[model samples]
Target: MNECTYKNYDELPLMLNVVQVAAVLGISRAGAYELVHSEDFPTLKIGSRIVVPKDKLREWIDANTAQK
Candidate 1:
């Protein structure tokens, strides 16, 4: 995966691809794929592509972080 860096969430695109997600979360590409495949993750299937909304990803991180 190509390296991606964002100074803040505001720099993120409205939707994130698997590689972007991996970069944002500092996880491996395979780890990102597994995360997107998880039942509770906020993912959208646009035709054959899978994406995660930036806002939803923020909310998900907030929600899950509080649990840990």
Candidate 2:
């Protein structure tokens, strides 16, 4: 797995661009772009750029993860 450099999600900005989201998620830059275009992934398109809200990302993760 790729390593994430962020200390905590709380320290992240309110919204993250695709590159930032890729770093946070430890995914490839291309993969991040792919995710942004996926049906269920949350994203905001600003002209040619795609971004994700921090809170929505957290919620999506929680919604998708299987409960222990």
Clashes of 2: 0
Give the poorly placed runs of model 1, Cα more than 4 Å off: none
Backbone clash count, each prediction separately: 0, 0
Candidate 1 lDDT over 1-68, as tens digits, reads: 54778989999999999999999998899999999999999999999999999999999998889553
Question: lDDT tens string, model 2, 1-68?
Answer: 34566799898899898888888888998898888899999998889878899999999888999999
Q: Which residues of candidate 2, in runs, are more than 4 Å off? A: 1-3
Please provide TM-scores, in order, for all candidate models, with all chains considered together: 0.90, 0.86
lDDT of 1: 0.94
Error of 2 at 58 (Å): 0.5
